[model samples]
Target: MSDQTTQRHPNILFILADNLGYGELGVYGGGPLRGAPTPHIDGLAAEGLRLTNMNMEPQCTPSRSSMLTGRHAIRSGTYAVPLGGVPEGLTQWEITLPKLLSDAGYATALYGKWHLGRDDGRLPNDQGFDEWYGIPRTTHETTWLTSPGYAPELVRPQHIMEGRKGEPSRELQVYDMQERRVIDAEITRRTVAFMEERARGHQPFYLFTSLTQPHFPTLPHPRFAGSTGKGDWADMLAEMDHNVGEMLAAIDRLGLRENTIVIFTSDNGAEFIKPWEGWAGPWRGAYFTALEGGLRVPFILRWPGQVPPGLTSDELVHGVDLFTTLATIAGVAIPQDRPIDGVNQCDLFQGTSAKSGRDGLLVWVDNRLQAVKWRNFKAHFYQQDTMMSPPEKLPVPFIIDLYTNPREEEGKRASGWVLEPMLKMVQAFEASLVEHPAIPMGTPDPYEPPRRCP
Candidate 1:
């Protein structure tokens, strides 16, 4: 924002919404249309920079891993959400964003879902967060308690857990349907308290408030149930907005608005499951697919005096970019020992340049190269319209110009010229893999990447 402001690290409050669709927000053209009015979230867009073409990995674990590590999930061995019973998550060798920030003397905490890992040494506290309090896995696990034929003795129930760095994470309670409904509220409350406490100190803080809402079993809090008059979906959406507004109000009340960077985004596109499905705005497909609907999600950043207000950019931005961008903003140096896929987007965020400093990225769905996006065009090697549908591997990669066909329905008619750049992008990534190599899935700790000399 200002030269003085740039001298000191600013507090970062990143609020991640699980399975929030692009068009679900009013600013993105789905609020009222979707029977949910997001006044506070809409106001966030007006107050800061919004990216229309923000992209993420097709699934929760991959997207979150990419964001935290600044590397593709394939490289981190978190390419997919593990069903359970495995040593899954980032290796201890991986330098996470919170770890980086914490190393720089910031108070770091995550007050929601920490799906990266569920066991010791891999939990949020062990991964650089000073403290963490949330579920070990997804919100849908809460359904396991109510689902028929579920045997608790066979599969240990998911718990609402908490931990401090250098300590074993302790289970707090069962994350059941009731806990699911009120978890977001608890996350918000802790987040607000974290901000208030950190504001009193000289050290800046990095608080990641991961709200588990509108995902599966999209239950609204008791206070918000029937508040929307539409259904549980609409009510949950309203609750999400209200929770956001509460945090924004806290920032203002504590006078941290000018010195804090507030970010709002989703883990993926939208939920595709029945009875709890989410709209992807104007796009087709949903999470777990390579289509725009699955890869593209809503992204809003509010840095009062630094980032330009009411600015919407269609230039490509990915969830991985958050790691590099925030590192730059906090004056932290990223690791150079490994390949980092995220590009520095400081200029784009500050509105200093129109380009996003990135032109394309490889699209992966569970360790498989599903597609490649370059500029406004994408080449899909596999087609899976929705999460429920089986992916069809095509003999020839289908291409689509997103500007003309956002729905990707006329991919057969796409120009052949786009194939060159798309393939080149894919080839470049594959080449990088040959040198640095991707970490194999379920890689154990005490890992060390091979070193190659020029």
Candidate 2:
């Protein structure tokens, strides 16, 4: 690792959208065609690199945990979203990205939805952030207060929370539909303020501005409710575009554009809910499934002079790869005690290399090995049509050439040889579990990895 004092580490502004799909932004394919224009986000891509084949976990909790820990969500006990008050999230033992950056002398703050945990020891501040403000769980709870036959004692109303490190989170207000409409704007405002303050102090900061937009029950701010005139969904898209523009403008205004790395991506593919559901462009299925639509999402990164502008790559990069990639960029050492699934992709991001460090990644949905994506080929051990349907366990691995079947539909068969590499990747991963067993879902705190034999 480089000396922190000698090398001024670049600031990281990671803006994550909830349930945003690959085709949602204009650069990849949708924007105006989807009835809302994303000029601001598109401009960001025009000034940076746009990744077409970026893959994430099938759901929010899994993807987020994977990225932060640089390990598979299954290894960290967060393979799926916690439901029915299940206490599922990252254990205290996991080494998160924000924690690493903080140790490297970077100030950290998280604004927006944090689906990682709802308990004291599992929250953002507890993990690594210096200060944080966001919902402790998913936005789906915002509707719980209004649902028919709702009972407060059964499931308490979700609240907007704020906290600093070493302090309990302060519950602000009930996060209802009205509050949901305005919360994103607040996140952006606080993020901009944090950027300004850190820039003034001449400190490198890692700002995880996680936005809760275009998720289920998608609603735009009151001011933008009807701005698009296409519908509420389009209106929400327009609002998100404007908010992202504000953040970009702030970086430029603070004169931090040249030194800050601005990233825009999502935790999942798209919403599986109806009416408020999002478009995955050309892919099939939705969030919570093993299909391409569930695994692929939009990813854009901008770093003036350092990262080449207006370049696009189809290189396969997993969401967990960001951990090692950013840690390398920030001059931090990745922990060697655990199996880190993320590989360094700094060269790929800087345009010096056309190939990603990883050629394949195992796809886990609900703690089960559902699929394996090796280069442009994919082999599925389980098949799921949508989030609402039951998964079918196949006796034989089903193979598809993603180049010809981006939709993963029946057509353009892949050679049987593709299975050999896929099998090798899966076998190596399973063998690793023998030494470092995966933490079971809902594992309590004060957790420790099982002892490895010499």
lDDT for each residue of candidate 2 in 1-454, tens digit (9 for 90 to 100): 2335424799999999999887888877888877799999999999999998899998999999999989999888899888845666888999999999999889999999998888888889999999999899878788888889999997789889999999988999989988999999999999999999987788889999999998888989999998978998889889999999999999999988888999999998988897888888899988998898888899999999988999899999999999999999988999999899999999999999999999999999888899999999998888788888888999888899887888887666678898988889988998888888999888888889877667
What stretches of model 2 exceed 4 Å from their correct place?
A: 1-7, 84-86
lDDT of each: 0.90, 0.90
lDDT of 2: 0.90
Candidate 1 lDDT trough over 10 residues, lowest sum: 1-10
List, residue by residue over 281-394, the lDDT tens digit for candidate 1.
Answer: 899988998888898899999998899999989999899999999999999999998889999999999999999889888889887899988898888898788777788899
Q: Alpha-carbon error at 122 in model 1, in Å?
A: 0.6
- The clash numbers for all candidates, in the given order, read 1, 0
Deviation in angstroms for 417 in model 1? 1.5
